[model samples]
Target: MGKILVIADQKDSAIATGRGLELAARLGYSVDVYAFVYAPLGRLKQTAAERNALKQRLLEDREAEVQARIDKLSREGQKVKLKVVWQKDVAPWVVGHCGKTAYEMVVKTGRRSESIANTSTDWQLLRECPAPVLIVAKKKWRRTQPVMAALDLSSRIAAKKQLNATILSQAIALAEAMDEQLHIICAVEVPTLLEDLDLIDSRSYVAEAKQAMAPHIKALARQFDLPLKAFVVKRGPVEKVITSQAASMRAQMVVMGTVGRKGVRAKLIGNTAERVLGQLKTDVLALKP
Candidate 1:
């Protein structure tokens, strides 16, 4: 495991910090907590005394809270380092710094609702950040439960195999570290036109897909020397199918890879992995390739 950076803001720092520490402890990784503060330049243009006073107060407040969180984690047997950054562009700063650093993953909490036209900094980080992002929603995180790795077998990109494998491996390692179960899932979406034309038998297609995925699943099981739970193959919107399977299986976390496609094409066409992140009720360990 590499360094895990926890990105937080003034309002959500405590929860995010705590969650990051927990994850680092489970994964046996070094943890660093970062808080981004918006320090207005206009304020700096004010009287020297006023500017100094405001800067001093902000620094003192941020330091106290950060230290408290770090101390709490230390008491819990987690060694965490904290840093407070005064920056206007939180998302860009994270991306730039992470690109230069050796961090393998960035962990943060996700908001419930997002606007169609605008998104939160966390959302932006998911779309554009250089490092892999794990967004933990507000719920009881099951440290010792099954993790579902959702895959798209039909992706045109040949690189997907490597990306998917990394996702699955990480999920399995996490589960093993926590003494939990790991399940692999693939959503087989049959186009409505093909179904209507009867050109492809949906049931047969699903079966064939499952059969093809069997070899990979078995290989993983053999490598880990663990019994492989049944592989799931369903026909529907990939996002819905993945979420339903994870929920029905009572998975603790959904592991998957983001294709990194962007703009109107990605939005109009939609990617299964991205859509699942937006809709899943459980925490997501999203890898970028």
Candidate 2:
């Protein structure tokens, strides 16, 4: 029911619209995308006539992409609506808009370029965006590639607890739409404060954490109408456990929550979700709690 800000990367337009429109349809959210294009300084330094020619070329290119997308949607008989604003400096506007209006989530087509100095927008969004960010990879999802939803049962905030439910619900919707497997996982680690205590038993502690998580997991299962086996609680560093499980599951994407990078817990080691993003090759859907 809320707004969804989709920042299209324009890597593969068909793939972008396919993933974007699919998600919008699933959530029934009005899609507003800043269909961004990066023009190097050199390109803009040309003479007026040359720059006009370049502008024409860019316009034609964009029109072709839009037409192709329209054809695809027509063939598929999908009426998913999208409003696109062509923008150059993208990430700043996206972050700024989040403060202006509450966006439920942010969607994008591809990952940022590896070089931060050159292409840092998407990376910055991952760390700073107030809403959830869904970065869709180029490779279309396959039915066998599970959609992994990383759950943290230990977070006590009412907001975060509700966010876990939202993450799982969105993941379920994605899995159902794509007819893919849904893999739910939770990782447990001994609290650092408890290190001084002589009572630390990693296995027993992990077992108890899993036991404590059981009722919550079961409740999620009942709520989602999913089987208990779809959920798993494991022992390890949360980031490491998530990436490993996703790799083992051959996950196409991982859905997890964040509290932004400005929170106190985010200062010491950065958000675990960001670390997990670094380790994963699969697509990531980062939700905000």
Candidate 3:
């Protein structure tokens, strides 16, 4: 297959890079590790020549550091490439780079402290990156834990329906490669106005929702050969249900979809999946359509 792009954060957690290496080894894909470093000019109170010299020194130092880290993670028979760049805005740079190059996936570590809004680099990458983005958490995967795929089954839109398929396929591939089980989860959200107007009981609404989704779930089962025990249907806010199910099941990763667009709609994952990411402690594989 194609190569995987591993973005190394300034913090150098190694979690993202290490995960990328592991996936590359398993999937037989080459890896391109990019370490970003930037030095603010305002912070340096020196002559122009001195500032330039110091900046060059900083770049050399960071390159050496990142090289050493990659050398430690290197393995025999693995095709790995490394690049060190002085880019302050990593997300946009990556988006531009990926637009030019083809990669199977973009792997990066996520910050749990980011807000639910689409403001962080991770959120931007999820919305704009051409390739699938895998946001890794600090927690390591356990052998028995499964990879969860969260689907928006209620959406009648064709794009969303196709996105559900994409999410499932990616999750299945990852689960198989990792030798882990695959679990499917879908949340049915009831309109608040129905409850406010007393038009329908919450239980009734949820029951109806599940009934409507049964055929789609069955179709998925037939297409993917998923067992009944592998499915989980819950009624609640999408983000809450996903986070709860992932935690309860001790999932190693939660695969979900994000709509890649511009303007207001670009905030697709921010509305639901972004919230889930904010609360979830497990790794996430975000697909785009």
User: Tens-digit lDDT track for model 2 on 125-175?
Assistant: 777888778776665435438888998898778898899899999899878
TM-score per model over all chains: 0.87, 0.76, 0.90
**TM-score for model 1?**
0.87
lDDT tens digits, residues 69-144, model 3? 7778868878988888888999999999999999989999997555335478887888789999988887653543
Which 10 consecutive residues of model 2 have the lowest summed lDDT?
74-83
Q: Which scores better on lDDT, 2 or 3?
A: 3
For each candidate in the order shown, give its overall lDDT on alpha carbons: 0.73, 0.73, 0.84
Which of the predicted structures, 1 or 2, would earn the higher TM-score when compared with the native? 1
Q: List the residue pairs that clash in candidate 3.
A: none
lDDT of 1 by residue, 1-289 (tens): 5789997635545666766777788878888888766577564658878887887788778878778767865446566777887777777888888888977688877764555565566666777788888887666435436888877666647687677768877887878876777787877777779989999898888787777777766765686565765456677778888888877777778888886656666556655556776766677877787
Determine which window of 10 residues in candidate 1 has minimal summed lDDT. Answer: 136-145
Q: Rank the candidates by TM-score, best first.
A: 3, 1, 2
Show how many residue pairs clash in every candidate, following the order shown.
Answer: 0, 0, 0
Displacement of residue 136 (Cα, Å) in model 1 is 0.7
Question: What's the lDDT of the predicted structure labeled candidate 1?
Answer: 0.73
Name the regions of candidate 3 deviating beyond 4 angstroms: 42-53, 115-118, 139-144, 260-269
